[model samples]
Target chain A: MSKKQTKEITESTIILPEDIKKEYTILNLGPTHPATHGIFQNILKMDGEKIVEAESTVGYIHRAFEKLAERKAYYQITPYTDRLNYCSAPLNNLGWHMAVEKLIGAEIPKRVQYMRVIIMELARIIDHIICNSVIGVDTGALTGFVYMFQQREFVYDIFEEICGARLTTNIGRIGGFERDFSPKVWKKIEQFLKEFPKVLAEFESLFVRNRIFMDRTIGCGAISAEKALSYGFTGPNLRATGIDYDVRVMNPYSSYEDFDFIIPVGTQGDTYDRFMVREEEMKQSLSIIRQALDKMPEGPFHADLPEFYLPEKQDVYSKMEALIYQFKIVMGENDVPVGEIYHAIEAANGELGFYIISDGGRTPYRLHFRRPCFIYYQAYTEMIKGAMLSDAILTMSSLNVIAGELDA
Target chain B: MLISQSVQEKLINEINEHFQDALVKHEVLYDMFTITLKREAVAPLIRHLYNHEEFKFKFLTNLCGLHYPNQKNQELGLMYQLHSFENNYRIRIKTFFPINDPVIATVTDIFNAANWMERQEYDFFGIEFKGHPNLKRILNVDDMTIFPMRKEYPAEDQARKDKNDIMFGR
Candidate 1:
């Protein structure tokens, strides 16, 4: 192969007449704007109120997660998973762990699987509430935003009770949760279940049927199913296009096949449809969580594999064998099985996939994350074209563009 | 559906008839059959797959690179995962390259999704994809000095220290 140097264009002249018939304005929706949600820069070309062209630039928060995963041990990547989509950390955690577990053929207990389902559903509800509420807030609806945030605060309280951390809740370990859910935690969840529906109803009443919200979102940024699929859109964005393809239904990792729930799809595939899809999804997620809790099985919470799963803390304190196993695991002394596996889960945003390749070492040989935000960002320009500038913000917010996952 | 032995036999025969000695080896692993070919024979074989009625891999699922540090015959592996929604079947095509020089042709024209995936692979593993439209550093910054995904790249702390020292004139 030969290298060729291409010529670069420098400082092209733009001629504007004093008596211009038409005018176009460039709006820089910042790496700091409230509507951006994260560090994102969109150069919007606007003619009057309609957007002509939009260019999206990410990487303001790129931590090089793929590169980091290659150097870290398989078990050590869990915390890093929390940072991918901070809104839905458990899904990323489970995705990465399930990929590694598949590669090594680790058999987790049924109880552990149910626990994972519950936590993942909770995370999904948290993400949907925040995303939907933020969309409402961006559209100048303050009541719905406050109601949803109050509900999210309740959900975050539950997370804090389960794990020490709230936002970056690195809740689960490799094979199972860091600790079993206490009885108080179950009671708190039960209380949340009883109270959340009323708040959701309040939110829906405020924004779902409001004439102003409906007028702004009904036909704005409409995308066809064919165009969405062609652009590789997944999750709610794809579901809004009338496709009932959820990874939990299609692939069924973490024993999601055992749970029964409906995948809510949309008709018009517009901003309203996207918002409605997420709203219906929150209800479905709550139902799934309830079912998971009701059908919670009785068994070991973690896998039985001593080498992979961490031994009990009591055993680590008492038994020499357990202590040695703990040291081996913590010190990266155990050898990881060699193989490749791709595990995907229905994340709050979309299909969060972790493709792991092991070379029989403590660290992974290669790791790749199939981030849904990247594809959504790719389709952003097309989605926002010909829409009003405000509709661009509405569409982006409904899409729940997470820059951490986008620029990872 | 389980892949029938007759189908595998037919595929092998068809590949052998078309490519002659250019085909290296083909094998099935983990319920997926992979066909290995020479670098020059890739485009023709891909075209054959695309056109053949029985094997219409219309969707390019993913394209990834694998590096083997001390492998003798094949040091670097480029794997393409293709899905045929029409046939409800999938196939992986892999080609090998020497460790020192890993070059593969870009299949962006076949499927546009491969464009970003190939760029990502190139960004990390340093595998050059010839004919790629916008072959620039995607995930990393444009002026990144090292390919961070390579096994030879330094750890995070060492790399950070090196950069700091260089910037501060140590």
Candidate 2:
């Protein structure tokens, strides 16, 4: 705020109360509204139906993850990361694991890397399925949402087969996976890959060509490519604006470069394009998972580093050395390298990044989560400032602001 | 992994050519170029990088704050991650100051994305954004008196007993 900038803004964007005659009504949207999909609120000043001014309030679910990460050991922090973007919990878990591994300079085997890629892609697919189906629900198409939601259950079955949990899956360890993908898990993935596309096609046919859905989403909540970039939009939202800035493409991690897939971009960064971009990404994710599974190498599932990785249960029960190693890992006796690092992955929503500074201690000195929802949600008021109320809801759905991620 | 060595050198060269004194420190961490600067130099340097013809680092990819209590005067740091669509390169900028006088110019004037990020930094770390339009807490309660992200907050206070544990269903 310089003097010249203040003068320039006061002359252009500001309107004093005396200059306008109409009274505007303020509508509070949510700290607990169903439409928000999380616990956050917006107070919209409305002139009839058009929003005149908007004020947003977040933090209903702020658990102070960064502060908590400071005190918790690196291994203990994975469960907390699971709760950040709960829809893509495995991705968050893997992303944090990769960040810490990078700090420690721990090398993951090729098989372990491919397994990570499979799980991450599955998580991305589940994320997009929820987002796109929710867009259908927002567009008043209940059939497609119901049809596609069952597909999400299939993916969740895969998660359950891998790790015993569904939602907050503390899936993998710091170095690599806790165990190999069991035969049941492989069968579930195979079933999902075989059966999901037909359901997806049916789901898309229900919404993509429907006149009502197209009308509601095609031109609604539209943002330009430049404005989106300036507002720090990424992932499907940025791609919807025709910027092919996928983190996987830009900075490949976890052997993502080994797989070949296309990054989809949309010409118009509207609600529809956002929906379509995510749908196409889901298809690409399926393709990546196929490639990863086909090229899966044979090796030890978990990294053999006793300093960072937990030993297997059978081995720990049988061997004295494995028992001591397990005890040492569980009790946080491993040495942490003193370093500062940041790692990112193209999450279901956008670019989810973790910035960590370690001081050769069990806990990080400071940890920051670059939750994409937090950054993208900042542009909400600006994008919907002059749009209708319905468009505002559509805009939010398109942006996919998970309250968990936004408040973290 | 990182771009060519030439691109990396040219980027460093451009910054050094313009503001040698503002460049406090620089490093290549995990293949991403990281440059730290004095607190006052951040805004102008980012603005220059955004407008430079060779690298239009137009996107403010991410922004967050950090608190390092042991570092005497440099207790608080603000980090800005930038991306250039033109060149497909990324970099990080960090600036630090004392917690008692944590002040830095706002980049919200340049990128609208900085509005809530700076507010979140203020909410958690109590770092002041000097010229931000609405610099109140964005991710915490309005009347919160203490910044939670600072390292001095006691660890034992985090342990609570009333809630039901998932393991025991207490």
Candidate 3:
């Protein structure tokens, strides 16, 4: 290679901008950055420490959950929902089940509905715990995150006892739980409810009044109520903007209407408001669980949909009718009514929705998951446009944009 | 319930009176009032709903593309679910277009949230949202030619030779 040839190649490749004054320093914040907890990237054009403009580049971990849902049977898709917001897998599982039930118009037992309420509320608590504590961690308050994570583990233990799986729990069947909650599961729930509030209060005390934490989060990355609504914000993120639009309250499902709980709202739509709103929500979720436990109903655990729900193991072996039903259910050959329905639940991060179009097939004709994180991430570039780079991390964490849910 | 049957009927009648035959059909599917409209009527109808005093469907809850390869001319569809916080009501609006010219006017102008949602529709099913500022593939790579969500593309890869039954000790 001649020196002249090397110089010519360099000149051709690196053409200088026509106006050098307009050129901004381009920095890739993440496809993987220590600050970004997930596998999404932000292309930030910088003016010193402040961001002149930021472009988010996501789908690095896109798994095509919608396309896969089309090929999977109605019951088989529950596991896929678990991956969407894995911080609260049971919520996704129940949301999917509820959608299926809506399509079939199956009547759920009151006891089963109450059981679902307890489980769903527990999931909401852990979801808020992760989002709030991570915001603390992002604001350089790691002590609170470490302290709150223990409660998350206790919740996970309760989940494991109920469903035999912790993270990606394909917990409940289409109609209801596969079996009744054991005495051990009840004990664990009692234990979690008793211990969780004290630790949550301690965690809240650490950051609610701390001067440095307040300074970092209070006015940083603020958005107005109108902008948040226009951006399709929901759950805690939307409530933080003072909209108070909760799917659970607006369109109650799974006995949520029976419980009395206030939807927490925050003003200014800043990172601090988001953190505080989630903290308050966790407390509300605890109250909802307590209420569900107090007014517990006594009835069958599973709904009367033997064609959809599998029969007992011993019955399947002994009886011909049970054997036929078992084979049909296992082979995904159960009859599904032809209809189109949309069901949304007040998931941890936001309104997690499932829109199903069935053509009376063994599998769904088309299924779409309205993942709230996907919408929230689309508004990220606009949210962090003029903010400092460090505040951008705090804003993203506070929004609780789970990558699996975002990319789905 | 946020919307009663009479309110839903009145809303449908109002939409029909204003838009004429733009509303192709309307039905109540599992308590949700769904209206199928002509493609040209979608963008304007959404804007109208957003600004209407009686029905302020100002928030877009969800939007996605659908494919029906067997449905001859109308191979692609777009569904938009909008909610009115003031009334606590929701409605599903749908429009269909042929695959050869899969174009529908963008709703990003009405709802900023539709920007990425339209991009996602374009990305997966190749339904082009006209007038969108940056209409490009979102969830897929830029250079990929195939729209993965279309019915022609199977969910499982048919070309993988490594996953034969013999290899799995079956």
Instruction: Please say which candidate is ahead in TM-score: 1 or 2.
Output: 2
Q: CAPRI band of model 2? A: medium
Q: Which candidate leads in lDDT? A: 3
> What tens-digit string does per-residue lDDT give for candidate 3 at A204-273?
7899999999999998888899998899899999999999899888999998889899999999999999
Query: Candidate 1 residues A89-154, lDDT tens each?
Result: 877887777777877778889999988888888889989988899888889987888877887888
Q: lDDT order of candidates, best first? A: 3, 2, 1
Instruction: Pick the DockQ winner.
Output: 3
Could you tell me every candidate's TM-score relative to the true structure? 0.87, 0.92, 0.94
Which 10-residue span in candidate 1 chain A carries the lowest summed lDDT?
Answer: A10-19
Off by over 4 Å in 2: A1-21, B1-5, B157-170
**Model 2 Cα shift for residue A49 (angstroms):** 2.0
Clashes of each: 0, 1, 0
Error of 2 at B48 (Å): 0.7
